[model samples]
Target: MSPRFEPITGRYLNLTLLGRPHRLYIEEAGQGIPLLCLHTAGSDGRQYRGLLNDKRITDNYRVIVFDMPWHGKSSPPEGYQNEEYKLTSRGYIQMILEIAGALELDKPVVMGCSIGGRIVLYLAHQHAKRFRAIIGLESAAHVAPYYDVEWLHRPDVHGGEVSAGVVSGLIAPTAPDNHRWETLWHYLQSGPGIFKGDLHFYKVDGDIRGKIDEIDGRASNLYLLTGEYDYSCTSEGTLDIAKRTGAEAQIMKGLGHFPMSEDPQKFISYLLPVLEKIRGAA
Candidate 1:
């Protein structure tokens, strides 16, 4: 049967976090258990547009995606551009906590990709009891050198175009042309230096290799799924984390760094089983 499209609502909320007030853009659909989805670095919540429109998942989950401050429709707090906006582990967790509290989400299943994926490790370690489960897509225990941050922000280079070109190389060669382009489109629109700032967190502050043992999978279901073609956060790296933390891990075939957007159908194929497991556990 063809899947029906569900109605999605977009709204904005002004909340104070990290000692500052910022506007956050949120898109939500369906009605059931909450699923808070976080987007890849430099990109916005638009990555989950397909899931928000899918009735099958939406029928069983209230899916919500939000743009981080300074990304997408969310406006940055005062003095954001003047001072470099680097993402910190503490600040990232605080943002999620604030958003969830404001939305009154009851132990939502938190999912994220790329840097979004990296942040979930912190969430699981720091606030496991607050979430029903945490799914880290293309997450790794340690993210070594893959893409150069300097090249991404060089004044001589066209930041957006160059960023898209670099990201395109990381996507799976098997991904559809349309899907690949659609995924690249987000990078092309991202603000300058935003990607680099996010990488600071992904490659540096987000490292949890030594602390993976601190996470209790029994209390907060931790799952790691990496794309077959993701060179940055390889499946081997993710599997290592899973082994260390006792969290479930899987490799998505024919997928890449941006699985949810690169090929939603293929992504869902892998995600469905994970969701079912979470539901059963709940």
Candidate 2:
């Protein structure tokens, strides 16, 4: 009997960024226009396994996903133990552009979820010409926190389980058990306080209410899709952003905060039309 092997290939790149040396893990499948996938906060590139394997999307796009430094197969920086790992908008933007440069991609289309979603807006506003297009899933400029993040990093708390528990409610009640648990599994494996650290950027540092007007949506070809069930990044907020920034927007039904991971099939159904529009424009 022949063993099964996925078309996906995983590799590591040695990158030194923000003045520190680090190793990054990346995966790719299919080929054509490069389509980069960014995972949600507290998770890793593994969240995109479904997208990489889906031929409908990959047949026309080179699907790429990477574990940010300190996430998934990517190890923390050389001296990570001594430092606090809070992510800042300045650092997040630099890391993304640097990764794109390192890969030598020719203006890849960027699609991001959650924190990944937030950065896509920044990319649009600051470097619209660098990408073919930007897609934000469960994205918004600013969302006031309903809970204290300190709970994700308490000395007595089991950070991983607690993080997963908090976000479990954010997934749609109808998400399949397999995908829902898989999404939470990523959070369950997160480094101590990494979830809390990433939120520092999402809830505080990366606020773009003032700067969103600067984005030329026509040039960036911005698309914003927020799940109807997502309390974290509400559909109302996304619609508001679409109105303010001239971005094409929609509210995904029967989905939640982690759309791509929680319900890839349904999410892809909606995503296919958007991809068609992007491809036609390209």
Candidate 3:
């Protein structure tokens, strides 16, 4: 199929949520049912650039992506730079709710990766009626044996370089050279300690094992997709979450932590089937 040749539209808007004003960078393409994408921690909406440009998806859906506060072109509220930016479940949910309201999205399908993935479960559990569905990429009920946070804070080492070293092993060994490097490139450009701060939420505060049963798949169409090469949040762990939550789970082969960026074409191949299933259910 010929790729969607239409240009993506982008804008910066200030959203006041949770008692703060956040200037967010948002992008969108196409028109139809809304597809809201959340990026992996320490990264930005750039991960979904391929999806935004894909005609097959855009033809049927309006794909929206945004850089979270302090993550990309988005800027944190005043005085946020002075304090540690830890992502709380409540705060994260509020941001999504406010964004959805502002965009006037009608029960958008929410998809996220990593910390983003972990939060989608919370979204489903806390506000099932707000979303048409929730898609989790590299998500699990719990993540253990957290990575070294000190290394991410060391003065001698560049945080980006250290972050790259930490994540390099998690990408699929078979990933294409360009895609692999592109995934690493995002890490290399991330703000200092941002990855570690995000992990504080992903591995610590985001554990949903105790409440996984509260998520109703029939209400929100919860789905989990994990990469075969992801040891951080392994397929086994994701399957366990699915079993507990009664959500459908799939293991994508030849993919790693950053599926969309590591291999967009292959990731799309996997996503299309899930999208079809969701549409049928809707």
Candidate 4:
């Protein structure tokens, strides 16, 4: 028997973000139009392993996923143990632009999930010219805070276990046990305060409902795909965004917040048509 290899390749890069030096990790594969993927809160680029490996997608698009600072294989800035980690909307947007610039990706189509999902709206509104298209998975303008952020980082509590347990219910019951656990593992593996930091941006500062109408994109240029079972970013909320922005939208069935990772095959079924549409318009 021969050892099988996946086409995925990863590398490290040193970049200056927010005027500070940091080391970031990135993975990529396939070739063609650039497709930059953003992971959900508390997770990393590994969530898109399915999309990265799927020849159906990779065959037509070059896929890229970079773990943000303080997440996955990426390391934080030079400061050691000074302040609490927090993700501000400006910083988040700046980081994405920095990464895209550093990679020298020319007007790539950007797709993001959860926090990644929410930010695309801002991207389309503020920098639509910079991207060929934007896709938001489990996207909504605002998600009502479901839990207290403080609990995830308190001294008495175990951050990883509690964080994983809290989000476990967000996954659809239909997800395979293997993938469900894998999704939880990302939460479990998250660094102390990192998940909380992501959520600070996700819950407190990442609301776009007031300016949803301001986001500029045609039906062919913007997309919102939310899992039916995702309570955090309900399909209802996503549909409302679509209604206002007049962007393409769909509610994926039998999937949850972490669609690409939770069930790759099922997620692809919903995604291929979107890819075809993007390709046609491109």
Candidate 5:
């Protein structure tokens, strides 16, 4: 297996969604129902940059990834709240529409991790008919108070750099030294704003757990992927969502929240079954 991923350049573009200018950067390859990949907080679509190398991924689906508003190449509008960045589930759904129009992609398979995963559930609840399938990798609807409170006040407890460093440690224990360093550096670069934004998003956003039934009301395929070690969301939490949404769930062994960075091959392997379902639906 090669560590290097060939660079894929799409027509650089922008769109206004959630009242922010969203800079869309894409690496499009293969052909089928598009799989729009969204990254967790502090990272951009580049997290999936290497996954394109996998023949299974590239041969079967058109993978599209972009920086969310206020993340990476995307910049936040002036006076924009972190809430704008951590958008309510509805905000995220609108974002998908905005991004799709910007890129001229029809409703595609929506795939996301962490907060991105949460977005998938929300979108499914609102417009299940639009998507062919929805995949949530390590997703959840709520955060534990103890952990949330601590992280909500993280900087005061660990100082800015240490807090960022702690997050970096969570990326990939098996990653190359430089990769780990870069991953940590990525969080620090996003800084305190993202943390505040994420917390605000969590606090203000509507819980889709109760509304998950709306998702199951449709024929869309729902799938959940999690690292066996991903402490961010528990198996129980994911299973609960799966059961409620009538979705299938899988937990990959020996991984954490950032599975794409931790183990892309395993990530894609588990994703293959779900992809087959999505392809069949199309």
Candidate 6:
């Protein structure tokens, strides 16, 4: 069977950055403070479809979601030197800065999942004034664990095997079927090259746990959101990040890594108050 497309649409933004016509698939809607939404490494930014389209969040903020180069419908750059640029967090961050400037958004709030979560944390650490607030769902303090060679050297997989791997050892297998199956399926086949590059990027140039204090001092707001059952980022790990950085942290009860996809209504409930706090600060 063919893969399912997310039931969301906004704009197909194309802009020349670094002398290339990068295809940027963005979901921009509502009218308020700019909120840029990013997805995990293996999946396209469309992972944010549910949240970006929801009335509760969008009604209060001008939410924007976009796929990075080589993921989803966003075609990669021409003459792309995969080895030189693939999978580096720096390159992704550069694209993000350029994308934000192109959208005419100024220091918007950033929200991400998994790797997306990591990216926002990196930005908050390195470039705090660029964003109004930072929200990470199942975010991490470090990168080496997930991007190890053992996790990437595996052979290509079909949906069943991918689903099994995602539910095993990390998220609760008893989670909702459609949410579980779809989220796994989408990430499994997006692009192995891009995924592999991402792993390489983190392994070589990733370490933020030691610098949490530096990140906290610069950002206006930092929030950590994760599911109680999210073994991918253990409760201990998230708590350690929160404690060191002195940021408000939340662990959603009975949920797992994919809390936004698993239970968006509950996800939004946790998200709104934090966003309100940021807005009030502004």
Best by lDDT: 2
RMSD of 2: 0.9
Shift of residue 147 alpha carbon in model 3, Å = 2.8
TM-score of 2: 0.98
The whole-model lDDT of each prediction reads 0.88, 0.92, 0.86, 0.90, 0.69, 0.71
How do the residues 1-282 of candidate 6 rate in per-residue lDDT, one tens digit apiece?
A: 987854355677889865678877787766699998877655676556667768777777888888887778877777665443456567667778899999999779888777776777788788778888888887776755552344443566443344336444455455667766666766666665555555555445655676777678334488888888887666777777787777678887867777776656666778888888888888
Between candidates 4 and 5, name the one with more favorable TM-score. 4
Of the candidates numbered 1 and 5, which has the greater TM-score value? Answer: 1
- What TM-score would each prediction reach against the true structure? 0.95, 0.98, 0.95, 0.97, 0.83, 0.85
Against the correct fold, how does model 3 do in TM-score?
Answer: 0.95
Per-residue lDDT of candidate 3, residues 101-203 (tens digit): 9898999999999888888989989888888889999997778856567798668999899888899988899889998888888889888778887878877
What are the clashing pairs of model 5? none
- Between candidates 3 and 6, name the one with more favorable lDDT: 3
Order of all candidates by lDDT, from best down to worst?
2, 4, 1, 3, 6, 5
Tell me which of candidates 2 and 4 scores higher on TM-score: 2
C-alpha positional error of residue 164 in candidate 1 after TM-score superposition, expressed in Å: 0.8
lDDT of 2 by residue, 1-282 (tens): 797988899999998888788899999999889998999889999888888889999899999999988899999998888998889999999999999998999989999999999999999988889999999999888978889899999889999999999999999999999999999999999999899999999999989989887877777999999999999889988988888888999999999999889999989988989998999988
Q: Per-residue alpha-carbon lDDT of model 4 for 74-181, expressed as tens digits?
A: 987887479789887899999999999999999999999999999999898899989989999999888778778889998899999999988898899999999999
Model 6 earns a TM-score of 0.85
Name the TM-score of candidate 5: 0.83
- From the highest TM-score down, the ranking of the candidates is 2, 4, 1, 3, 6, 5
Cand. 5 Cα-lDDT: 0.69
**Model 2, CA-based lDDT:** 0.92
Q: Assess the local accuracy of residue 249 in candidate 3 as a C-alpha lDDT between 0 and 100.
A: 91
